[model samples]
Target: MEMQRIMEFPDRIMDKRPRKKPRLTWDMHPPPQPQPPIPPPKVLPTTYHNQEVVNGVAPNHAYPSLFFRGLTRNGSPPWRPDDKDGHYVFAVGDSLTPRYRIIGKMGEGTFGQVLECFDNEKKEAVAIKVVRSINKYREAAMIEIDVLMRLARHDINGARCVQIRNWFDYRNHICIVFEKLGPSLYDFLRKNSYRSFPIDLVREFGRQLLESVAFMHDLCLIHTDLKPENILLVSSEFIKVPDYKFLSRAMKDGSYFKNLPKSSAIKLIDFGSTTFQHQDHSYVVSTRHYRAPEVILGIGWNYPCDLWSVGCILVELCSGEALFQTHENLEHLAMMERVLGPLPPHMIVRADRRADKYFRRGTRLGWPDSSTSRESMRAVWKLHRLPNLIMQHVDHSAGDLIDLLQRLLRYDPAERIKAKEALRHPFFSRDPKRHGYPL
Candidate 1:
């Protein structure tokens, strides 16, 4: 069971994953049977007797797993004090149950906070996501749990996404235990003062990211949000790399330096927004910085939206800054055009009514208009093209990286490269020194 828990993480990343079709869901309950060519289960109304329900998530013939109301079976709050946000109030050495003891706090979000804990029975350190006792958040946690279970069941080798250790209803909060992981890519970059990673490191990170996307796609799921913040380094270890740009200063005072991950192993996380290909995609998805052009234009989207996000993430990893840093839709579109060339005539023509205001008659964008402030226009102008941006930060394999970014960031979703194809791009296969993990 020890070996079964987690071993051979390298094999989990299958480089030759078949180019297959995949989709995912957020409102979606449980995924279909594992593997591609998946056939949908019939939705014949039915019920079960003497059913073993975990947190009211029971096995049903029709929906199979969508029948749960919330994290608790009776929809009743447990006998425990909660914060103003309905988040569980926990502390170090507090007992989550008779079995798990809180060690420290890992992080927090809108849903709830994640606590580092020691599993008494398993005797291992784990991270538990203590969901808010609120009904809506609890329900969302159930969906996420189902999705994680599906991924874990299918990905027997522990590949692509993070692995779940266990889960339960603790004091009415959906306590999900995950194999503890290190800091997120976003956190690492912030701690490093937003210094860019070496090209060799970027290549390894890119490959694993594509493989994870390919795995999710192959399973018919689309992780709507793909950003550095959602990607975690498997280990927290790092080594100091002297800043060559400031080598003289470093030689004298040792002030400027960069921390590079000792290992390139990573895992994808945050599946609360995952949606199936069959589900409606009109509503906006993805973080503002990583949002695809199609999502902004309200022209519907699919797997390619994830590809667009991958392009942004790769750029951020290489340059240590988000590709698009605007909150306004028009400015976001403007940034897209400024960096990746034009927005494509067809994309502008196909823009939904809301997006039309950002465009003029032809392919020209409505910029420098009175509504657009001077600061906004200047920011857009300051951005370099895809090639120039990559070349500015990366010293080697810039050409291959640029070409891959072009395909991944294509304004036309139909023309965007698939995750499987992106994994095979010359960038990954170019140099032996660039492909493998950091030594």
Candidate 2:
């Protein structure tokens, strides 16, 4: 099975600060017409025969061969223990038949806490995300494991996406083993701020991201939480038993550093929030700053939302600032209007009506008010005049970069430029060998 690649990053990257010059000119093309929708399966296949319908699963399952390994048959959870059936407490080793040591806690999210541990036989680092017992959602964690297994074979050289080595269920917790990487993109960004990257370097990063988005879009998958924080970098390759002594010696003297391994690739991190097209019924997901226009109005949006996020990140990289960082939801919409104009009528009609179903109220919704709306317009004008403002820094102006940003950040989802098309833009017209991304 081929591990599909999304983006490649060069090793030994310089951490130099970016120039304060205004953006240079660039190009953006419109998105292609929406593809024809696929017809639904009208007839039930043999796979759907005399089977139990437990936890949203068909009775007779036809397992996928190549990618779908260790798939759970949607087992249902019984009543909670306090009710005398669902309650249970598991110590570190109580779950695993051959349990290992609990090294330390990694994090705690809305779902549950994650712990970092090491497998004895495999001698590898693994992260185990744990969730409380819920009868209705017992199979939910397993679904994530299944998705990760499917995505395991996907690899783009120089990309640092994680792969599942193994998965198992223990008591109330479903433990999934994954390939570990260094600090996440969030940490990297904080340590190295917006000014840390040059325009060219930022463009390269954007290109890689676009390729990843494009690949995911092709598979009809949407990474609801697409942000710098979710990207990972994998550097040193694991050394086996035969090289134990040498590996230890190298570890002592930093042989890994001396050898200067290939540059680690950028990989998308969290998949718990990922959803497949035609399968996923929800429309609401993603962070506020990177959220798409359609999402703000609660419209039934799709993959195009991810593209909007990519564009926002690109602008932040180029200008050392967020494209839209307002105080309130209405102000956010106004800010967007300053650049992309008013919200489309169709988008407003389809806006999400069930606010409690997804996120908190009073949170940003991308709508701009009149007062702030006018200020947003002025900001746009100033941004358009960015070239003149940047005359003191580099030899380029805002004009040099606005065209590219304009096309990528278009408000209209139908008109938004796609990843594949953006790659062919003239901004990357130089050194195809060094920078020509194979997205």
Candidate 3:
């Protein structure tokens, strides 16, 4: 069956440049103000497992708990609790609104804590993200809730994005309930000792991701943060819930499950950094490794930025490591140019005033006359080509995959392939069923 095509924005709309921001500041708006603290919620005893204890605290207790799960002996999980100073004080067996029963801490982020809970009314498990009582976090939580609500209104290519079960204010904290999902792609990769996924698996994940992104872009929403950590696995019959003791052992051994299923669906999560396509977003929105060139250059970005991130993610999935691994902007740009070739002169010229620090006049190269010596700069630029790099890491030689990656990684946002267009690419057109695989 042919996939339904999502309408694309007009060329004029896609080509239109965003309004210029102040040359001095990269932020589009001022940071949120701090608000008076709200009193903590009162916890009531529930009839659940009263003997269960989490972090030395009995059930229905409230105290800051430490939950750390390492990916490998040397690798750490992305979400680590701040034991020295943390605001997440919810405990297992605690009841929220008398409908949801907190089971255990799933994860934690900058703005909130995620808890695995059971929904009494629905008789199913759900993930609840409880924002900190701080006013700034509360506001961000509301924005995320709004985005999730809008996204849940539609299904893309018969696959639904992560659903928002419900949201409400509980004890001065904004709590968002989402459908339960398994570990993130980051966790999956880490569990397998950073081994690259099979080609067919990558194709399945890539297709769904493109559909999800296209669905969001169709509604003018841009997920500024797109990475392995944010892509979660949809729970399946093959998935088995690991007990806390088993998880602790798996963290040390770097093996979560004995054998991973042949296929599993995925969903995009974490909408805190999401915004309208037309909004002027902060230049430092995406993670450093997956950030788009336009974002690094401070050129205003749009929906195409998300596609750029998808390109980075696809490469990481194939290589089991970031395509560009650097915290410094100049070094990051150097890494990108090494693989993708130099940025277009026109793009460099249109960059913000900060562009002067990296690029030289009448040159496509960067890091001009800075602390780094010319010899070192030349050496860095002489890195491996894209094809050679991919061939060395990825086990497959499918030309279609390479073609799609090239289009998605274009330096010029206007020239970069849109998510909807990517869905129609020959890479996804191949029938997985013919290969004896169900996607």
Output the number of the lDDT-best candidate: 1
Write model 3 residue lDDT over 9-64, tens digit each, in one string: 12211111121110111111221232232333433321111112222222222322
- All candidates in order of lDDT, best leading: 1, 3, 2
Which lDDT tens digits does candidate 2 get at residues 1-439? 1121222222233333221121110011111232232333232111111112222222233433222223222222222232233333334322122333344555554455555555544556556555545643446655665555545444423252565655554444455556555544444333333232345555567667877777777777787778665665564221111222234553443222211113335567667777888785465677667777777666567777788888777666554455666544555565676566655554554556653222223343433333445665565454433233233222332444556666777767788887788777766554534645321
Q: Which candidate would rank higher by TM-score, 2 or 3? A: 3
Clashing pairs in 3: none
Candidate 1 on 278-384: residue-level lDDT in tens? Answer: 77664799888999999998888999999999999999899888888887898888888888877788888888888888877756788767888888888899999
lDDT of each: 0.73, 0.50, 0.66
TM-score top scorer:
1
> Candidate 3 — which residues are off by over 4 angstroms?
1-86, 156-158, 236-259, 362-364, 368-383, 432-439
Give candidate 3's TM-score. 0.73
Regions of candidate 1 where Cα sits further than 4 Å from its true position: 1-80, 250-253, 434-439
